[model samples]
Target: MQKKSCGFFSRASELQRAPFINLPLHTGRAPAYLVRRMIRMSHAMSKVIIDEYGQVEFLRRLSDPLWFQAFGCVLGFDWHSSGVTTVVSGVLKQALKLDVHGISIAGGKGKKSTSAKTDILLLAENFGLSSAKIDSLLYANRMAAKVDTAAVQDGYSLYHHVILFDKCGNWAVVQQGMNAENGMARRYHWFSDNVQNFVREPHTGIISEKKNPCALDMTAAQSQENQKVCVDLAKSDTNNLKSSVYRLAARDTLDRWLGGDMVVDVVNTSGYEMPRRLDWALFKRIYDVQPGSYEELLSIPGVGGATVRALSLIAELIYGAKASWSDPVKYSFAHGGKDGVPYPIARKVYDESIRYLYGAIEGAEIEREERTDALKKLASFTTRMFPGQ
Candidate 1:
């Protein structure tokens, strides 16, 4: 079935609101003046920046295609809550155009309680790595079995740094650990511990020792039975939900998002100008807010300059949502939208974001020189992305 969009913004009091408002279209391309401004900024910031290869490597791996799909399965590890697995599945269908099945492993556990680092490696092992080696690694750590043979065999990939916002609790839910040394036995640290900083306790559901294959292997008819068991398990409703049910709910929520059934209010709005968190010299830009562009959006309660720039870029590049005002393209977030979806972008949110980002940048590890340079690059990219308007 052709999936549908999710429903984050259309609920409750906002039901009367259009799920999405028009993000008006702007005309023309980037201006030479803005380009020149960026160049000047870059020159001013021609010093103070360092590059770390490890950080880049981590970012690159987490962005891997296969890793994301496997992440969905390992997290839920089942049939019903297959949204995470399916995001990749859908993309794969378009790219490779191949029909693929992703198993899920979900139960009633909060994001904080799930250990993706341990679980992903477990899945990797199940794909073919020797459990004897895995077992030895676990034994050496004196860790208990929170992973079973079935889980290892069933899931193999994972995602890192996915952020989830909880409106009710007002907390950020994220997969906190993605250490490379996690799955490797030889590279295991002898005296140090990563688990202490891991977002949560190691999962306790998976049995370390292999049990009867018949019971452990929940496939086809058995998979159906497992689903039923999970449903019934939820009805029992104890202090702790079986891992399966929690996995189901979390996946369902995320799926609703993937399917566009739910709307996620992007916290990161139009980053009208470049981010100055890095040293200007390294990034080679000193681009600050474009006169009225960033401040106009930043004046909003939650909107930040970055969000403005981002929204502008997306509006121009993907949706063509424009900002308002005859103000030069350099002076506007974009051509304003009739309904003001992304353009004119939310004023309340934008300003708040700038204040937040400024603090964040101050705390960031970047030289002023590098920071200015990076901003210039961002401005250049933004200008190029919008071209002719």
Candidate 2:
């Protein structure tokens, strides 16, 4: 099969916008009746996708934010709610059978998210993956979470995490973070094939309605020099780093610390603050470990957002290596049809979509060639509708 191009996987232009999907934080569990229908619809849709495109391609589609959002809508979830991420993932987790689909999902919302390692090991053993391959998958899972939570210091804090993988170890990640202040959620997507370096612009796409004016994006390509400096500082003496922090904290004014006459916005100055509470013991441990790269330094246990921010500031202020402070969000959407901007979700239409897809898959089981051609036409139509996806 020929591979199709997806814009999210391309690294040619950093300025090009990624596909967008907004997720507003809404409290409430999806009704049991709605969830049951969603499970059935998700199972049918996933079956056809895996059967037609294979497990790897299915993983690729999940890594695309636009496709994932559409999938959530097709499953009858509120398109603009943060629940779309968690609900869709939860539905897929229950719907996809490893023995049937040759794929498995691990981790989930809140406390369930912490059990990913255990789930991965169990599922990998079932898949007969080698010890080394399983270990690599585990590392990938950990690093994906770490990169989003620390390296990219957007205000959102991750609350939901799930990794979808196939028998061959190809994987996709859909994790979401919440901004408690604004009550919005941002989602991060990752595909194994698209990532070459975990520390540099590694996300396939990041989706959010609100973009922070001054996010500390350490994973940005422009931050490469700063990343190198950060690694060097981590390997350097803790005393020198502490002295730099002290000097930064002792400054009387923001302009003096910034070394300019420029006025600083009081609200956004939180991003620029030199963290007064530095973990000197953690720094000592980091110094002992002597991580050769920023990624390695980040993978070290206990390196949270605070540590990453402090390091970036120190690198910029004292070492003359400036990190990028641009928010990494690619695009935004304010409303969803389900939210009654245009119209509410029509149950009859939604049910018809599910029935049509389910019936088509059942028909394909009997008339594979004709169904395949029809599916090709559908794909062509979708390409025309969503070009560059």
Per-candidate local distance difference test: 0.25, 0.74
Q: Estimate each model's TM-score.
A: 0.20, 0.79
Point to the candidate with the largest TM-score. 2
Q: What's the CA error at residue 162 for candidate 2, in Å?
A: 0.2
lDDT of 2 by residue, 1-389 (tens): 22222222123332233323447899989999979877876776688778776899788778767557766765667766899999999999999998778999999999999889999999998999999889989999999999998888888999999999988899999999999998899999999998899998888778877667788899898899999999998999988876666565555345333322222112113347544345668888999999999999999998988789888887887678989998887531211133332333344533433344444445433346534543554444333323343
Instruction: Please state the error at residue 23 of candidate 1 in Å.
Output: 21
lDDT of 1 at 264: 25
The Cα error of candidate 1 at residue 85, in Å, is 18
lDDT of 1 at 272: 31
* Model 2: ten consecutive residues of lowest lDDT: 259-268
Candidate 1, 159: how far from true, in Å? 3.3
